[model samples]
Target: METDLLIIGGGPAGLHAALTADRAGARVVVADESFSLGGQLRQQTQWLSNLPGQYGYGKKRGTWVNEQLINQVGASNVQVLKKHTMIGSYLNGNIGVSDGDKTFEIQSRKNIIAPGAQEEAKVFPGWTLPGVMTAGAAQILINREKVLPGKRAVMVGSNDFSLEVARQLNSCGITVEAIVEEKNQIICSDGELVKTLENVPVYTNSTIEIVTGAGEVEHVVIQTPDGLKEVNVDLVCIANGFSPILEPFEIMNCHFVYQKELGGWLAAYNIHLQTTNPSCYIAGNAAGITDFGSILLTGEIAALSALEAMGFISSAEGTEQKSRCWRELANLESEKVLQARTEMLADYHQKHELDLPDYFMKIKGGKMYG
Candidate 1:
């Protein structure tokens, strides 16, 4: 398949980018691992806010927004290839993708990679148990497959995402015995704290010492200041946090820095979202962890940036979009789970000798070795 643009991940970022580029009269090809599109949007179950100018501000369920994007993709000149996994880098401006039985060579002038994120599984004793899984897996079971993970569950993590997953599990009629966190106290607002407290008790200053089970998870041991508490649970959802899908960026040889707030290692993109390789651009959470609105706007802005780089869109038009997108991005970073630690970012600028914008100067983690 030959096209002007090839979006390597059909989630929120990829789909949004594909739609915008196609609307600009560029032929787009969107490939995803799932049978349909929408990436992590499929796992979400809340209302989105503070979107870009094109999206506007609206309160809509994750399902609704995801469906809407799929419809938009269908209506545009974007070709959707479901169940296709990108196997290799864009060598000579072309990429190799496989759909189970066959491999296809897609040649494109530009590429937008939005592979999304995956939950990080913290290694502990018995974490490899059958019933031990990431919160995302449980989300897929309940949100997508409509299957309850287990009758009794010991949820780990106390962030907004983990709490939301607990609520989703409760909605599915599963018994969430307890919500555990490594921190001493919940970090959410009082209102959210009150609501969650009413449903499940939060065991703060605790960590899952070990997950013990025979063939599956039978119980979990929580290490606390006082002592160890054993909770009998059939399933354990390790919702510690997520990490960006960085394999593709690494394969493309992009320079990276470990930003814990952004969910570990992320590609270093300029204000224009272009990576170290001028031909490649990073978008969405893959750039760093932000809100849903940031994801949409970043994806759209990336499309514009790529278009301008390819001479399909004007630099002036792209600049206007960038200004708006940056505001939304700032709003997201300033008020979300982990705000940017501006001081920690001095290393990147000093070392790389690049004049990065404030939006790209967020560094909230430690140094990563390979």
Candidate 2:
């Protein structure tokens, strides 16, 4: 299929990018592997409001916004290829997209790769049991499918994402036994404090030694700093951080470095949102972890950058859009969200025998930087 632009993934990033590019007068084709358009929205049941000014694009914002975005995209009449996955990305700019048994060749003047992140799973005894599932999967089962993951559940993870997932489970009438945290402290943001107090105490510095049940999970033996504790639960939800879905980038040969802060090996890209390969761009959790405000703005910046490259917009127009992108981008930098990403991209440049961008070198700490 030939298009002015092709967006891979139907997540918040990709959907927003599609709207932006379409507004710029591009015939857009959005290819997402999911049967529906709302990516993580289907799995979420929380409302995170942004601080008045930047619009309603904040972390964990309500499902209403998700519905609003989807509605706008539908009303705009952009062609959506649902259940279509961009399977193979080649160095020559041609991509292979698959829905089921068939794969099609996609050629576009510009492409935005917003394939989103893959929620990770941790290894534990009997983790392969029937009722053992990723926190994301549990969310989907409850929020999207309207089916309970299990009657009672034990959550495993230390971050706000896990804690929020636990609260969602409880709201759905699923009894939560406990939340297992690998870190010694809770990572929930100040606003998220109420979730930890929702009748679910966190078990810090803990590990599930074993899960016992006949066919499905019945209970788990947790070993914590104090001692062994037996918890009875029907399900175990793993809420570990995610790894960016780099397969699309890798198909285009975007080099990645081991950056733990970004959740593992991440694609090399600069602040402008351009990858090492100039033609491909990435955003959202697909690149690294950051707030939802940054995610939406990055998607816009990435689309504008692609538009600039494709000569769809004038240089002056590009600059105007850039000012907005940079301003929003700055909102995330000092917060430790994009710090590791900047350092990693610099490292990627150094590994390729290139110099780090002048301004970025100073940002990584004066004495610690090379």
Provide the RMSD of all predictions against the true structure, rounded to 1 decimal. Answer: 4.7, 3.7
lDDT of 1 by residue, 1-370 (tens): 8888888898888898898888888888888888978988986876665555466566678778888898988877789999999888656746789999989788888788888877788788998989888888999999888888898998888776777777778878888988888888885543653495466867889888988878999988888888988889999988877777888777777788776777777887666777776767888888777777778877987899988888887877777666666655655544433344233234555566877554343323322111
How does residue 86 of candidate 1 score in lDDT? 86
- Against the reference, the lDDT scores of all candidates come to 0.77, 0.77
lDDT assessment of candidate 2: 0.77
**Candidate 2 residues 1-370, lDDT tens each?**
8898888888878888888888888888899888888788655567754421345445545476567668979988579999898889655678889889888788887778887788888998899999999988998898888999898889888677777788888878998888888788776775545544567767889889999899989979999999998988999999888888888888887777677777787777765677887778887778787655566777887888888788889867876776656554554443465677666666666666665434444445322312
The window of 10 residues in a row where model 2 has the poorest summed lDDT is 361-370
Question: Residue 236 deviation, candidate 2, in Å?
Answer: 0.6
